[model samples]
Target: MPDNQNPNYEIKTIVEIFKQENLTIPEYQRPYKWTVKNTNQLIDDILLHQEKSKYRLGTMVVHNNNGELEIVDGQQRFITILLIAKVLSDSNFLDKDISYFLTHLKFSNTISHKNIARNYQAVISRASDIVNEKFAKFFSERCEMVQIILKSESEAFQFFDSQNARGKDLEPHDLLKAFHLREMNDSDSSEKIAVVSQWENIKSEDLAELFALYLYPIRQWSKRQSARYFSKSDIDIFKGINLKKSPAYPYAQILRMLESFTQHYKNSPDRLFDNQEVNFPFQLSQTMIDGRHFFDMVSYYQNSKNKLFNRLKENEQTNRIISTLDNQEYKYRTGDKYVRRLFDSAVFCYWDKFGLIEIEKAVKVIFLWAYQIRLTQQSVFIESIDNHARKDLMLFNKIYEATHPKEITQLLVNFKIESKAKNSESVINLAKEFQGIKNEK
Candidate 1:
């Protein structure tokens, strides 16, 4: 248990937080990513517990960076409650004092700004009739948060991780946001805000889905390994470059060089206002930071021209292969549930590196290899086949980087499985089809 004597925290009610204290969302914090569903659920929860004398919302870990209280955890909940307050104030449901306090509340410009506004309005519209002065009074007075204020930034994050592990875990992306944001602590406010906006603009669900379905799998495949479930630790894979720790920390060396040059150039500098060292405040480009770079990569993957389905719409050969796979008559089930994830990984890798130039050949080879494995190996459990296919595809991808389809086909054929003869036959047919495509090209 943390030391109680010097916890440096106090329990604050909604009214107290708004009336007495000034709160700021740290630049490291992700923008408001809560959806309307989350907003409605919170409202419902508050309403459900309104009968009680006091309701505890939960814990919020904050850091007292000098005098400014930077929220480290419970950002989602904090923003949601602020939205509730906004609704109450707008509807004239809150007391004059509380409403005035809410009026002074400020929010940083985050990517989820529009969504937050939309959801706030929705809450107001939904509770227009039900929320009155009495309801607002109860909320401000009764709803409480155990605000734990820590002295150091590291302590705040440790507290956050410990609490999240015990309680309802935040999504992996949320953790990544926090981690990356911490790295940007010294960055200019505008840089932090811009990165937060880009990070939040990508829907939370889409970010999670992309990592789980495509990015994670492709990464694993490149290493000649089967993709496993994504976890918080996997966030490191997406973190492309660590700006702070890198030797080429773009500005630090240059700043030092500039300072030295300036000192040498001036023998006796004019005694200007209060001999304070001149500080250079500059924002690094997004590409310099890991968090921003990761988001940029995700954006690229999502909108890249060489994307499989996007290419399918324009390329007849690509469409034909996909069509054949989708056709029910061929027993090539492309149903949502039955879609081979391995093929998705393959397409992502091929497109990410090579683009549309050789996309047809790549897609056709991947689909046929995947299709044949799916067709012939029935007796073996589906899970085991999936595991094997991932490994085979992983190996094929690595070898394919240096060689062509023939070598990739040979690598795929090497995987030992049930019904070897049938698998071999399928591979032969695929090779023939692949050769015909190459011949035509």
Candidate 2:
């Protein structure tokens, strides 16, 4: 294995990569995962950029094992290009490395074989027009990729991890994990491994929901910003001050202060016999602390959000309020669902702030605030729900600034319940139960 300090990597046409050596698929590589949609996307991308002198397709990493270039990444794109060459037919003129790929390529996974066959048909239908030599040569000679050739498979994998982590297919949470992990450079290696392993053990969809449904909206709403969309661009919200590189700003100092106290409390000698473990008090709406705290905060809040429902269930009044909203006729409408999300988000942050203190009233206040938008508007949209989130008193803003439960739970917004709105008159009358306000109609 050569020193990975400087791996051999450079720009190469698809032809150069293929012709260099026998492109072998490593055992670790997942079966070719490209689908018809992915293939069509590649074709459209190729067509869109064919006129350029050189279009950098993307990156590929290969482990050069005894001259056999084992593909550590870009297997999907590599195979798709070969399939394109095969469709353009008599393409021996363009490059023969891809021919070796087509003739010898085998997949043990049935899904791979199925998708390969499906994408083959797609290419035939899409690439038949490129039967002429010009387009074929352009694909073979003009399109380039950054081909990273590492000496060992481990080096190849390391290179692949560094490059492919930011790929288009990743969700925002995945990006956040990568970022925070990088920030944990000074942390204990074992703790870093444990956090990442624990994170990966979770279902991907749940992590996505944690960020998009709860964390993102709550963060934005607390700042009095619209959060209808949570995308890669908004990940900076979770990435707070990197303490290693941070100045002594009071906000950053507060997180540092809490970190010191929590660590001392947990590591204090009394913990062993008493089992009085103290976790860093993580407020969902608080300014984020960087690195391990970010990961710990994520794991904590995820479990906290799940446990909150059970906590709510423990209280009869909160249960009754929840039951009331759940039984509403408009419960399943898109607007109604958004309204419920609004309620749940507020409940999540409220409980985070006050530990279910007067949670029944807290939930009722949130319910009235959220569901009122649904009852008052004939058609509630993402915008309406988001706007209503910060409308007037701004419920999240109230929760953020308040030191007491009543500051949020007791706060009320006055808007006439529109009886003409789509929600059954029954949902409108729930205000009477929730807040003692009757529909003006």
Candidate 3:
């Protein structure tokens, strides 16, 4: 084996890469899942940039295993280019010998090959005039790619993963994965492989959506603010685990907290464990740099019954109330936006305290406060509900430090009482009625 510590790299045209080495897709690689839309866009990009002195496609990561170059990344683009060459050859656009040699290039026997072939035909049919000798020459000779030849397959994959995360095309969570993976350089190879495998098991689109819809909102709400879209910078909050300079290391702190909880419960007669409620959420903590905890929390909320109202397992009444609110029939008439906002706020508050014990009362009071705001406010847009939820969340955070559920209820009650005094007669009446139900209970 050569000294792969400093691998060779070069800028090569499509024709040069093809002529200089034999390229093959490794079996572990994902099948060419690029759609017709993707191929069409690539074609359009190439055509638009064809007039430039040199059009750079992108970087390709490859490993030389006994002189055979295995493509570790950029297979999709490479295969697409090959299909273009084949299309031109079939059209008799290239010199006979050049066309014949192009035909000999092999592709992996995957479903993607068939799909790519279909897409090629569709592309050629749509833009037959573009698939000429001149365009073929431009694609082969003028278009350039950065060919990165790594020392080993692992290095090639590491390069591919790191570059993909930093690249413009990645989702925010993908960037997080890349950042954490970079930090784990000192970890054993098996540990790193396990992390990557587990991370990949959850699809990128699903992970991104999880952050956007739930985790981001909950984190913001915990600070008593309206939720915004998750961006690149916010990834730092989930980071800092491996950094030594940080005063509060999340990984160590979380492990200590779990240890304390276990010790506290060991002597208790009332102790019981529920997989859905507790065990599953803690399972992710077993791993270092566990972003899995955040994901697990989101999953718990998504799967729980009466998610908004029922925080504690014993709170049947709160569960019933939330179930009623979540009913499609009720939501259809009342609009889901108000209910969703209230649910999110309640969840955030519960999560901040790190347990559902005595959470039902807090959630009940918070829900009523949110309901009153919706009923009293004019022109109740989604934004208005979100603002109210954020305000409530802020108040919750302030009193959360006091370590008592009554403080939360009292704060919400005080806010409601103040708002009720300044509002219209109808609003006052509604508040009185809601109070009557609470008092009676």
| Top-scoring candidate (lDDT) | 2
Return the candidate ranking by TM-score, descending: 1, 2, 3
lDDT for each of the candidates? Answer: 0.62, 0.76, 0.60
Tens-place lDDT per residue, model 1, 13-83, is: 88777764556676546666678888888888888887899988877778888887778888788878877
lDDT string for model 2 (307-412, tens) is 9987787788788767766775667778778878888888887887888678887877787788777777788788987898877568888888899887876687
Clashes of each: 0, 0, 1
**Better candidate number, 1 or 3, judged by lDDT:** 1
**Which of the two candidates, 1 or 2, achieves a greater TM-score against the reference?**
1
> Model 1: how far is 41 from its true place, Å?
4.6
Tens-place lDDT digits, model 3, residues 96-213: 2344334554444455667877887767875565677678788888899998899766577567666776668767776666455545545565565455545555556767766665
Model 3 misplaced regions, further than 4 Å: 1-10, 19-33, 44-54, 58-76, 82-135, 146-170, 184-209, 223-227, 243-339, 348-362, 379-433, 437-441
Model 3, position 186, has a per-residue lDDT of 55
Model 1 lDDT vs. the true structure?
Answer: 0.62
Root mean square deviation (Cα) for candidate 2: 8.5
Name the best candidate (by TM-score). 1
Scored against the true structure, residue 380 in model 1 reaches a CA lDDT of: 35
